[model samples]
Target: GTQSLHTNGMDEALALPTEKAVEIALRTQQIIANESGVADTVDPLGGSYYIESLTDAIEQQASEYLAKIDKLGGALHAVEQGFIQREIQDAAYKTQRAIERNEQIVVGVNQYQTDESIKPELLRVDEQVRIDQMAALQNLRAERDNDMVQAILGRIEQAAHIPNAPLMPLFVEAVEAYATLGEICDTLRGVFGEYVPESWV
Candidate 1:
């Protein structure tokens, strides 16, 4: 199930996959199998000089990247310092710029421009669905034993504060007690403060 989306710089709200796009995508797979005969070969470009060189270069670069991250005190430290986030942002920006400059041709996006409006059937979630969910949660909380729920939540909070604590069992117990996601999160939030991202701009 491949759906083509018109995402303007990772914004998912603008995703509109048309029926024609879906048909084209399906036809592409058929063409690859029938016309291109891609399925007939095992590692079709395996021995090609260009493919081999590109593969080696990619592997070497990845290894170097991992080594640099290890020097910076591993993945957690890199994430905390926003190094990983910045790298991803930079890569996305470069790709977008390349597409805009026509250096990268993304078929329907950068090349083969279409003037016709493609209004696909969009999925819409009903407001009543959320209201019903909230009502169900309220009912569940009201019916469950508050004292037991609080005791389990308190244990969960205590476990979270301890370094390398086995919190999985406690989480399982909390869920079995019919504790809502918000309740579990809120309990943990009290112990561990919510994450606030550092200014990257």
Candidate 2:
């Protein structure tokens, strides 16, 4: 069963969605949920030949990719060795080449020639948002048990080094103790180090 949904705005590639874009995205989900009769039944298109074939094809491709990752010792190992980064880089490069060569038609970006440039309106967060958040964080640190935070953080660091150690509980404890994301990530960074991708460009 579906639990949650996120509908991306049309202008998401350019910038954060403007208010109008957000409204449209939300309305799309709302219409699907409220107006569309498809939501009345489960797997409405499941019996269709084309849909079943497409789903099977998607599953097959996904399984192949998962098998490749398993051979590379799972996701974390592959990422550490830069396999994922290189794959992403290769895919992006291929897409860009296609777009540039007219093999891919990207409307205004590639195929259409416009006499004037048109920029979409983008959503802008207020500068005070960061200031307010920092103030809240400072207040949280001033109030919560820092000793507990440090002790739990130490446990987290230790657990991270162990092979296949469960860490979600420690993370929950850290968050409950008001440990900032930066502090927790810094501990992991000290253990796993950062993944700096080799530029293919």
Candidate 3:
């Protein structure tokens, strides 16, 4: 699945009743689990000529990349300088071109011509859910001790300002003080200012 499927519209996906979500997940798992001969076999495509050649080529290419990154002072430095992002973009473009030119055949997407419309039941979040969540947040803030929260937040601020200081403890303390995920993220955004990369023009 695309990362967008999980991160971008996931809250709406999860807004289904918990039981329905679990059932859907279980069904998906079962389909994957029961895929023909996958479970009993070790290296299912071991004997396929094309599969072996492609796998070896991919492995060698990855090894070359690892070696290049090591020569360039490792993964973190490469990431900070956008090497990884550029490589990913190049690879994605190459893959897309291959698919478009029929060099690749992706099942049900480009290869299989399925005329059936995919009409799955999409779960919707009601206005009451939003209202209830706001009320819950307000109640939580009202019930929690403000003085302790402020003290913890001060400790968090101190940790953020200090060089090489582990901020996990401050995070734990904030969580213990009943600070919401949104609040923690907002505070970090205030310190870090959000990072937006220059996408390809």
Per-model lDDT: 0.82, 0.91, 0.76
Q: Which candidate order results from sorting by lDDT in descending order?
A: 2, 1, 3
Encode model 3's per-residue lDDT on 27-142: one tens digit a residue. 76566558654555656666899988888899999999899999889998887778888988999999999998889998877898799997555676679999999999999999
Q: How far in Å is the alpha carbon of 45 misplaced in model 3? A: 8.1
TM-score: which is higher, 1 or 3? 1
lDDT of 1 by residue, 142-167 (tens): 99988889999999999999999998
TM-score of 3: 0.71
Minimal lDDT window, size 10, model 3: 1-10
Please list the residue runs of candidate 2 whose C-alpha ends up more than 4 Å from where it truly belongs after superposition: 1-5, 69-82, 111-116
Q: Write the per-residue lDDT of candidate 2 for residues 1-201, one digit (tens) a residue.
A: 355778999899888888899899999999989998867887777679998898889999999999999999999998877888889989999999999999999998897779797778778899999999999989999999999999999999999999999999999999999999999999999999996766544
Judged by whole-model lDDT over C-alpha atoms, candidate 1 comes out at: 0.82
What is the number of backbone collisions in each predicted candidate, taken in the order shown?
0, 0, 0
lDDT for residue 68 in candidate 3, whole number 0-100? 98
- The Cα error of candidate 2 at residue 132, in Å, is 2.2
Task: Please give the range of 10 consecutive residues that has the lowest summed lDDT in model 1.
Answer: 1-10
